[model samples]
Target: MPCIPRLSAPHFLSIALAAASFGAAAQQPQLSAVDLARKNACMACHGLVHKQVGPGFAQIAERYRGDAAAPARLADKIRNGSVGTWGRVIMPRQSLVSEADAQVLARWVLAQPQQQQPPAR
Candidate 1:
Protein backbone atom coordinates (compact mmCIF):
# COMPACT_ATOMS: atom_id res chain seq x y z
CA MET A 1 0.00 0.00 0.00
CA PRO A 2 1.21 3.53 -0.90
CA CYS A 3 1.10 6.12 1.87
CA ILE A 4 0.23 9.77 1.04
CA PRO A 5 2.52 12.42 2.50
CA ARG A 6 0.82 15.02 4.74
CA LEU A 7 1.60 18.73 4.44
CA SER A 8 3.00 20.58 7.51
CA ALA A 9 0.81 23.29 9.12
CA PRO A 10 2.92 26.10 7.66
CA HIS A 11 2.80 24.57 4.15
CA PHE A 12 -0.97 24.10 4.42
CA LEU A 13 -1.47 27.71 5.50
CA SER A 14 0.74 28.98 2.68
CA ILE A 15 -1.23 26.94 0.10
CA ALA A 16 -4.54 28.23 1.53
CA LEU A 17 -3.36 31.85 1.37
CA ALA A 18 -2.25 31.45 -2.23
CA ALA A 19 -5.57 29.86 -3.18
CA ALA A 20 -7.51 32.65 -1.43
CA SER A 21 -5.54 35.32 -3.27
CA PHE A 22 -6.14 33.61 -6.60
CA GLY A 23 -9.85 33.34 -5.90
CA ALA A 24 -10.02 37.01 -4.94
CA ALA A 25 -8.35 38.04 -8.20
CA ALA A 26 -10.56 35.77 -10.29
CA GLN A 27 -13.71 37.09 -8.59
CA GLN A 28 -12.90 40.73 -9.13
CA PRO A 29 -15.81 42.73 -10.59
CA GLN A 30 -15.82 43.59 -14.28
CA LEU A 31 -15.44 47.26 -15.20
CA SER A 32 -18.55 49.09 -16.40
CA ALA A 33 -18.62 51.29 -19.49
CA VAL A 34 -18.12 54.47 -17.48
CA ASP A 35 -15.26 52.86 -15.59
CA LEU A 36 -13.76 51.64 -18.87
CA ALA A 37 -14.00 55.16 -20.29
CA ARG A 38 -12.13 56.56 -17.32
CA LYS A 39 -9.57 53.78 -17.48
CA ASN A 40 -8.89 54.52 -21.15
CA ALA A 41 -8.75 58.29 -20.58
CA CYS A 42 -11.95 59.03 -22.58
CA MET A 43 -13.14 61.33 -19.78
CA ALA A 44 -10.20 63.66 -20.35
CA CYS A 45 -11.84 65.33 -23.37
CA HIS A 46 -15.48 64.34 -22.99
CA GLY A 47 -18.23 64.65 -20.40
CA LEU A 48 -21.50 62.88 -19.61
CA VAL A 49 -23.71 65.99 -19.81
CA HIS A 50 -21.48 68.79 -20.97
CA LYS A 51 -18.98 69.38 -23.74
CA GLN A 52 -15.31 69.60 -22.98
CA VAL A 53 -12.70 69.35 -25.74
CA GLY A 54 -15.17 66.94 -27.36
CA PRO A 55 -18.95 66.84 -27.48
CA GLY A 56 -20.82 65.48 -24.48
CA PHE A 57 -21.95 61.86 -24.42
CA ALA A 58 -25.59 62.90 -24.30
CA GLN A 59 -25.02 65.08 -27.35
CA ILE A 60 -23.53 62.16 -29.22
CA ALA A 61 -26.49 60.03 -28.24
CA GLU A 62 -28.90 62.66 -29.48
CA ARG A 63 -27.06 63.06 -32.76
CA TYR A 64 -27.01 59.35 -33.50
CA ARG A 65 -30.43 58.31 -32.32
CA GLY A 66 -32.36 56.04 -34.75
CA ASP A 67 -29.25 55.57 -36.84
CA ALA A 68 -28.74 51.82 -36.83
CA ALA A 69 -25.27 52.14 -38.31
CA ALA A 70 -24.10 54.62 -35.69
CA PRO A 71 -22.89 51.91 -33.37
CA ALA A 72 -20.54 50.39 -35.93
CA ARG A 73 -19.51 53.83 -37.22
CA LEU A 74 -18.81 55.10 -33.75
CA ALA A 75 -16.94 51.97 -32.83
CA ASP A 76 -14.77 52.38 -35.91
CA LYS A 77 -14.17 56.00 -35.04
CA ILE A 78 -13.20 55.06 -31.51
CA ARG A 79 -10.57 52.52 -32.60
CA ASN A 80 -9.25 54.23 -35.72
CA GLY A 81 -9.93 57.86 -34.72
CA SER A 82 -11.81 60.55 -36.66
CA VAL A 83 -11.25 64.02 -38.02
CA GLY A 84 -13.53 67.00 -38.96
CA THR A 85 -16.77 65.21 -38.06
CA TRP A 86 -17.17 67.49 -35.05
CA GLY A 87 -15.27 70.35 -36.61
CA ARG A 88 -11.47 70.34 -36.86
CA VAL A 89 -10.81 68.83 -33.46
CA ILE A 90 -9.27 65.51 -34.33
CA MET A 91 -10.04 62.47 -32.24
CA PRO A 92 -6.77 60.68 -31.78
CA ARG A 93 -6.68 56.94 -32.47
CA GLN A 94 -7.16 54.74 -29.43
CA SER A 95 -5.09 51.79 -30.53
CA LEU A 96 -4.82 50.50 -26.98
CA VAL A 97 -8.56 49.71 -26.85
CA SER A 98 -9.59 46.36 -28.30
CA GLU A 99 -12.30 46.22 -31.00
CA ALA A 100 -14.81 44.64 -28.64
CA ASP A 101 -14.14 47.24 -25.94
CA ALA A 102 -14.47 50.03 -28.49
CA GLN A 103 -17.86 48.64 -29.48
CA VAL A 104 -18.91 48.55 -25.84
CA LEU A 105 -17.84 52.16 -25.35
CA ALA A 106 -19.66 53.28 -28.51
CA ARG A 107 -22.87 51.60 -27.39
CA TRP A 108 -22.52 53.18 -23.95
CA VAL A 109 -22.06 56.65 -25.43
CA LEU A 110 -25.06 56.16 -27.69
CA ALA A 111 -27.20 55.02 -24.79
CA GLN A 112 -26.87 58.28 -22.86
CA PRO A 113 -30.06 60.34 -22.48
CA GLN A 114 -30.59 63.10 -24.99
CA GLN A 115 -29.59 66.52 -23.75
CA GLN A 116 -32.17 69.34 -23.76
CA GLN A 117 -31.34 72.22 -26.07
CA PRO A 118 -31.80 75.77 -24.81
CA PRO A 119 -34.73 77.75 -26.23
CA ALA A 120 -33.88 80.43 -28.76
CA ARG A 121 -34.38 84.00 -27.50
Candidate 2:
Protein backbone atom coordinates (compact mmCIF):
# COMPACT_ATOMS: atom_id res chain seq x y z
CA MET A 1 0.00 0.00 0.00
CA PRO A 2 1.17 3.56 -0.77
CA CYS A 3 2.03 5.73 2.27
CA ILE A 4 -0.51 8.56 2.88
CA PRO A 5 0.76 12.09 3.57
CA ARG A 6 -0.14 13.38 7.05
CA LEU A 7 -1.97 16.73 7.34
CA SER A 8 -0.20 19.36 9.54
CA ALA A 9 -1.93 20.77 12.69
CA PRO A 10 -2.79 24.07 10.97
CA HIS A 11 -4.27 22.32 7.92
CA PHE A 12 -6.29 20.00 10.16
CA LEU A 13 -7.56 22.95 12.20
CA SER A 14 -8.60 24.87 9.10
CA ILE A 15 -10.44 21.86 7.73
CA ALA A 16 -12.16 21.29 11.05
CA LEU A 17 -13.24 24.93 11.26
CA ALA A 18 -14.63 24.84 7.73
CA ALA A 19 -16.55 21.64 8.45
CA ALA A 20 -17.98 23.09 11.66
CA SER A 21 -19.12 26.23 9.93
CA PHE A 22 -20.70 24.28 7.10
CA GLY A 23 -22.56 22.12 9.58
CA ALA A 24 -23.77 25.15 11.48
CA ALA A 25 -25.01 26.79 8.31
CA ALA A 26 -26.72 23.61 7.19
CA GLN A 27 -28.45 23.24 10.55
CA GLN A 28 -29.86 26.74 10.52
CA PRO A 29 -33.60 26.91 11.19
CA GLN A 30 -36.04 27.64 8.40
CA LEU A 31 -37.31 31.19 8.07
CA SER A 32 -40.81 31.80 9.47
CA ALA A 33 -43.44 34.06 7.87
CA VAL A 34 -42.59 36.98 10.12
CA ASP A 35 -38.91 36.52 9.43
CA LEU A 36 -39.61 36.43 5.72
CA ALA A 37 -41.75 39.55 5.99
CA ARG A 38 -39.02 41.40 7.82
CA LYS A 39 -36.42 40.20 5.33
CA ASN A 40 -38.56 41.49 2.45
CA ALA A 41 -39.29 44.80 4.20
CA CYS A 42 -43.03 44.10 4.59
CA MET A 43 -42.85 45.13 8.23
CA ALA A 44 -41.54 48.54 7.17
CA CYS A 45 -45.01 49.61 6.03
CA HIS A 46 -47.32 47.20 7.85
CA GLY A 47 -47.36 46.45 11.53
CA LEU A 48 -48.82 43.46 13.33
CA VAL A 49 -51.43 45.40 15.33
CA HIS A 50 -51.24 48.98 14.13
CA LYS A 51 -50.79 50.65 10.76
CA GLN A 52 -47.56 52.27 9.77
CA VAL A 53 -47.36 53.49 6.19
CA GLY A 54 -50.06 51.00 5.27
CA PRO A 55 -52.77 49.00 7.04
CA GLY A 56 -51.87 46.68 9.88
CA PHE A 57 -51.58 42.93 9.35
CA ALA A 58 -54.55 42.36 11.61
CA GLN A 59 -56.59 44.92 9.73
CA ILE A 60 -55.81 43.22 6.45
CA ALA A 61 -56.81 39.92 7.98
CA GLU A 62 -60.05 41.42 9.23
CA ARG A 63 -60.86 43.01 5.90
CA TYR A 64 -60.25 39.83 3.94
CA ARG A 65 -61.81 37.53 6.48
CA GLY A 66 -64.14 34.89 4.98
CA ASP A 67 -62.94 35.71 1.49
CA ALA A 68 -61.60 32.59 -0.23
CA ALA A 69 -59.76 34.60 -2.86
CA ALA A 70 -57.98 36.83 -0.40
CA PRO A 71 -54.77 34.81 -0.38
CA ALA A 72 -54.36 34.87 -4.14
CA ARG A 73 -55.38 38.51 -4.34
CA LEU A 74 -52.97 39.52 -1.63
CA ALA A 75 -50.14 37.52 -3.15
CA ASP A 76 -50.75 39.17 -6.49
CA LYS A 77 -50.82 42.54 -4.89
CA ILE A 78 -47.59 41.82 -3.06
CA ARG A 79 -45.73 40.81 -6.18
CA ASN A 80 -47.19 43.37 -8.60
CA GLY A 81 -47.87 46.14 -6.10
CA SER A 82 -51.24 47.87 -5.64
CA VAL A 83 -52.88 51.26 -5.44
CA GLY A 84 -56.34 52.66 -4.50
CA THR A 85 -57.16 49.52 -2.50
CA TRP A 86 -55.94 51.16 0.66
CA GLY A 87 -56.57 54.72 -0.58
CA ARG A 88 -53.66 56.88 -1.77
CA VAL A 89 -50.95 54.68 -0.23
CA ILE A 90 -49.02 53.07 -3.04
CA MET A 91 -47.59 49.60 -2.43
CA PRO A 92 -44.50 49.41 -4.56
CA ARG A 93 -43.82 46.15 -6.36
CA GLN A 94 -41.58 43.66 -4.59
CA SER A 95 -39.98 42.02 -7.56
CA LEU A 96 -37.21 40.44 -5.50
CA VAL A 97 -39.61 38.30 -3.46
CA SER A 98 -40.37 34.93 -4.98
CA GLU A 99 -43.97 33.87 -5.74
CA ALA A 100 -43.87 31.22 -3.02
CA ASP A 101 -42.55 33.74 -0.47
CA ALA A 102 -45.28 36.23 -1.41
CA GLN A 103 -47.96 33.57 -0.85
CA VAL A 104 -46.45 32.72 2.52
CA LEU A 105 -46.48 36.38 3.53
CA ALA A 106 -50.09 36.77 2.39
CA ARG A 107 -51.15 33.78 4.46
CA TRP A 108 -49.27 35.16 7.45
CA VAL A 109 -50.98 38.53 7.13
CA LEU A 110 -54.37 36.84 6.86
CA ALA A 111 -53.67 34.87 10.01
CA GLN A 112 -53.16 37.89 12.24
CA PRO A 113 -55.85 38.41 14.92
CA GLN A 114 -57.98 41.53 14.73
CA GLN A 115 -57.33 44.19 17.32
CA GLN A 116 -59.79 44.12 20.20
CA GLN A 117 -62.18 47.06 20.54
CA PRO A 118 -62.65 48.76 23.92
CA PRO A 119 -65.89 47.83 25.68
CA ALA A 120 -68.41 50.65 25.93
CA ARG A 121 -68.98 51.78 29.49
Per residue, candidate 2 scores C-alpha lDDT tens digits across 49-74 of 88899999998999999999999999
What's the TM-score of every candidate structure?
0.79, 0.76
lDDT of each: 0.93, 0.93
For model 1, the stretches where C-alpha displacement exceeds 4 angstroms are 1-5
Clashing pairs in 1: none
lDDT of 1 by residue, 1-121 (tens): 8998899999999999999999999999878999899999999999897889998899889889999999999999999999998899899999999998899999999999876679999
What lDDT is reached at residue 90 by model 1?
A: 90
Evaluated with TM-score, which candidate comes out highest?
1
Give candidate 2 regions above 4 Å deviation: 1-29
Model 2 pairs whose backbones collide: none
